[model samples]
Target: MFELAKEFGGIQNPEIVVKLFSLTLMGQVGTSRFAICLKEGKSLYSKISGEYLETDKQTLFKLVSAPLLISELPDTKRYNILHDHLLKEKISALIPLQMQNEVKGVLCLGDKLRGGGYTQSDLEFIFSLSNLAFVSLENARLFNEELEKKKMESELLIAREIQQGLLPRTLPTIDGFEIAAENISSKQVGGDYYDAIPTDNNKFIITIADVSGKGTPASLLMANVQATVHALVPFQLALSIATARINDLIYRNTSSDKFITFFWGSLDAKSKKFQYVNAGHNPPFVMRRDGTIERLSDGGLILGIMKTIVPYQEGSVALNSGDSVILFTDGVSEAMDINGVDYTEERLESFVKGLNGKSASAMLSDIINEIQRYCTAAAQYDDITLIVFKAT
Candidate 1:
């Protein structure tokens, strides 16, 4: 068995070694009552059969370390660990497969079938076999680990592709308004979303939301919200009803950790009336023609926080010529600079009022640029987004 294990171990193909070990074990047990315990003190493998047969690593480790496990083995002092006892008996190659200061496994051959204990020669043979087997096992383990890593990488790439496609590929055009939105996703996916939903003629619904958290779980919840809104919009239901259905759908579909701060509004082309609802979101700021600012904040609870919520009350503001509406995520107000001061709502208001007569696109760009300027050396804390509606 020792010579055969040595030959098989040298072969790069691990399957051949596995088969040899099994075949050897079957032969050993056939006619002898002798025990050929492996160096690791695992059950003896018969040379006649090529199989693992009966070796549990967990159980073997317990046997080697006393007091660590509940073992029924007798406390007889006569029983010695495979290596220590075999060395004392003078085996030629006690395959201290264990390296210097390293615990390579051990192999212990036992006495003859009808006899008392293992002879010196038998022990030497088993020691040789253990050294060879360790190399084979280590190689097999490394191969399996590499295989698993590649599999995970493939799946993650696919998940990222699907996420990108589902998001808005292009911003919708609003006749007299220039709008821009961005979702700088984290390494993990996010449920945070933005959209420019088309409503009646010349009227479009602009929305932005931070859906609780990030990742596959959040992405799934966001998908539900997008699907529900698109399906309900064509019916032209009241904003309150639309919100109500959305809330119910979210609450019923997700866990407690899942919720969304959503903001949506309809922009009337000729009337210049911006009707909006703020469902626990960062309010949209309107820079009035008179240089006064109004934070459009009237709606209901964040969706999915609970099973039922008060109808999202509709809020409206009539935009006079030259006024602009700025809708954003909390990421804006919360944006911090190197000094640790946040770019608060108060600052944003004063900043926009400064650009009173700017074009819609310019205002949007200016606002974003302002954030970057204010944040100076600090990175964005959350997903920063913005949309501008200009009453021309």
Candidate 2:
């Protein structure tokens, strides 16, 4: 016993421990054939040598609790099935591997090679050895799980850094325009994106998008969108043409399950004209100084669903002084309260109507505060992103 304990103390691999335990049991019991069955997570691990037996793990676990001869089993329907199976495989005895009164596994042994039945002393030794091996297997499983958890946490921290880098460090200071934007991710990394890029002709580009899912895959796709937008902005193509190109690239590269809701426009400060395209995105509200609202809704389908079947349509709106364009992802509108009701779009529009004279940054802050107050106790389930452009 002391030698067996010393041999198992240093091993951490479950498979190696099982192999050694099987060999030791066969040698100690003077048996040529044996079977070891242990439960691992949601599945069963079994090892058999010398003779093949079709063992039902659930049945063995349910019926066996103590050491007993297979021939001496009670003649009930359940026990009869196990008895017949053991006899067919020439198995003679059953010993349960237990820890703290709970059965963790079962060990089956065939008749001794020299022809006598197993005694009480032999059964006791076998039980003790089986439990010792089980303890080692459980420890190894726990250690591996901890290592996997740490690896995932490290990867998520790196992903968060990369996602932050993709956002604009400081929005461009466009003449006669006040711009403010904010993005708050959920517990996990999300795919909400917003950017403002300056162009050559006294104009700037404003874009916001929400990718379909969350986590590393979504962040990776968001990075691709950011790269594509920057690469195409230098050419100064029409909003319609650039949008079509982006749609085709995404569709050809990604699978059917992936897509993005996107909205973008070029704001010419001198002309005060905003030429925009909305690709299945939440239609941003153009709130006028007189409390009127116009929703920008003209465009093609969302990106990456399919190829650009029809050319995207472009819409243009002239921004007057005191007019505010409010853009946001679904996270803002779908935010829940303690009663599970959403802060709907109608509420958001009404709230914006009251903030007519507020600065762009103040409007952004008030909206964020309202959403946070509304969802005081409920957990946030998605990314919240908002961008406001006010004509000065």
Candidate 3:
């Protein structure tokens, strides 16, 4: 019996244990056919053929307290009921396979092929063997589950590295300007992206965008946006004309459901003028030196929604010394607290007012710290992309 138990322990497939149980018992105590009925969602699967009956799982719960012998159970008693299931199938022994004091499955053995009843010693031996096999089967299931989880975590880490490589490694040093940007993802690789590309003649193109989805799909789409922007912006094309072409390209290449909220601008140090377009993005706050604020609300529909639905409108602002621009994704304004309340736009506007004369880097750090304090250690649920550009 110990040798048979050891053999069952080495088997990974749970169903194979039932077939082996039938063969091993036939030699010892004349039991022949066997079946394993396991819980499948709300139903019960009684065989290896994948057949299941539409029944409440509570019916199986009744067998957890003890093993049942078909001949010994009184058919007329309400508490000893088998529902005539075993009698109809000619099963002589039913053993509960338990783990953590809960029955995870049942082992059923039919009448002997030679036509004899199962003795008390035969029933006890089968019960012990079923428990041994249950341990092996449960361990195998948990081992596979752990392996799959590790594989997924490794893949997400790789995706995060690739996404980081896509962003600007170092911000371009533009004369008369101080710039800094940060992307703090919410425990996942997300769609928030920011770039500061140096264009011709001491001019710089700055952009911040958010893709429509989460994880790998969002990161891939953000990469596509970066590729498009890099390809078109260097041509010194009109901001509106270049933006329209980007919309058309994205519309043709991707499904209609995918879109990007984008905002990009070109700053010319000589002119100290910023030309920009905002494509259905969160309006950026332009905080002036005098503590007055301006929200950049230019451009048209989000990219990839349709091909040139509305001609993108170009907007410009003349930057004076001490003027600052704050750009961020919805992740900043929509961050949630432990109580599920959002850190809203009104709070953000008030916070920016307090840091009226701070440097770009200091302002960015303060904003992130305030957001963390508001959340009170609640897990961030989205990507926080921030950019601070100030005229020196």
Candidate 4:
């Protein structure tokens, strides 16, 4: 048995090892037939057919884990059910296959060819053989799991690359204005996005959006939004009309449960007038040089929720020399600390209210630093996106 244990440990194919061990067991115990059942995902499988063999697998599993002598429990209901369902083809002893203190499978053998029950010594030998088979099977399972994990990680890396490429590498320089935007995604790819496009006139368009969900699906939807905005903005469409078109496109393209909170606007360099619409997004704050704050909140429903029911209302504001507009996703306002308290919108407004004199880029950096400080030792759960546009 010790020599056979070494041979079983060397076998690479777990299925082949199981079959070989069963044959060897039948020879030693003089059993008529032998069979092995192994756990696969949520169920147990045997060689009865290509599909799984339907039986009470959980009960059989529990029986093998503890000390059970079938001959001593003839009157028990559980023993009767297990015996009737499992011990077919004249099978007698059922031995447990264990690895790392966990039962991985079961080994069954028919009644002895000598027409008698197995001795105590014979049962112990069967246990040793089952353990040898389990070690080989567990090794194969772990190797396959590692391979699958590596494959998934490689796919996620590719997805992150594509999402990063869609973001602006450089903010389009509009005369008489300073613009800065930043995005810090969580470990899982988040759907936060921002962009700036320079039009034919001195005017340009700026946009910030957050698609629901994350990973490859959200990134793909964001790419679609980018393509749609770039295509329609050049047509000289009004902000309201353009927003309606975007809503229709997203609603038709994705499922009902998926949606995007969006804000976009056109800025006139010569007139210093900003025309915009906010579609169920977190209202952006426009801090005036007079210390008064204006919230942009006049647009229709969120994109992809349903088709445009009514024309999206457009809003406009005139910017002064020292005024700044702050655009952010919920990630900044909803950042959680170790104690699960959100940083909150009030904190963000207070932080920016005192920074009315800083440069656009400096203000962006300081806010991110404050967020990191507040959420110390806690993992970021959502994507953080910020855009600051100041009338210089």
What RMSD does each model have against the real structure? 8.7, 3.5, 3.2, 4.2
The prediction achieving the highest TM-score against the true structure is 3
Off by over 4 Å in 2: 1-10, 30-63, 85-91, 104-116, 290-292, 335-347, 350-356, 374-379
Tens-place lDDT digits, model 2, residues 1-392:
88887778778787888788867876787765667666546333343342333346677777789987786788888677667778876788888878679887777777787889888898888878877887777777777788888887776676677678899999999899999999988767778899999999899999999998877888899999999999999999999999999999999999999999999999999988999999999999999999898899999899999999899999999999999999999999999998999999999989989888899999999999999999999998778999999999
lDDT measured at residue 40 in model 1 versus the true structure, 0 to 100: 43
Residue-by-residue lDDT tens digits, candidate 3, 1-392: 67876787787765675467656666777755665555532222333222221231245456444677766565566534354655556667777878788787777677777887777777788788767766776766666678888887786676677678899989988899899899987676678899999888889999999998777778888888999999998699999999999899889998988999999999997788999999999999999999999999899989999999779999999999999999999999999999989999889999999998999999999999999899986989888899999999
TM-score of each: 0.61, 0.84, 0.86, 0.82
> Model 1, range 1-392, lDDT digits (tens) per residue?
65675576566555665555444533642222212334443343432221221332223333432111112334555333433443343322212344343544434233334544444554454444544565665565566668777775565455455556656888777666666666554444556667778877777777777777755666666777777877887888877778888898888878887899998877777687888888999888888777788888899999889865466799999878778788877777788999888899888878888888887778878888898899887866565767776777
Better of 2 and 3 by TM-score: 3
Candidate 2 similarity to native, TM-score = 0.84
lDDT of 3: 0.81
TM-score of predicted structure 3 = 0.86
| Candidate 4 segments exceeding 4 Å error | 1-41, 47-68, 72-96, 101-116, 119-122
The candidates, ranked best first by lDDT, are 2, 4, 3, 1
Model 4 lDDT-worst window of ten: 44-53
lDDT tens readout by residue for model 4, 1-392: 77987787777765776677667766776663555666755322333331222465556677777323456435687568666654443456667777678876766655677787878888887788767767766775666678778876776676677678999999988889999999998777778889998897799898999999987888899999989998998798999999999999999989998999999999998889999999999999999887678899988899999999899999999998989999999999999999999999899999888888888999899999999999999999899999999999
Q: What lDDT does candidate 4 reach at residue 41?
A: 50
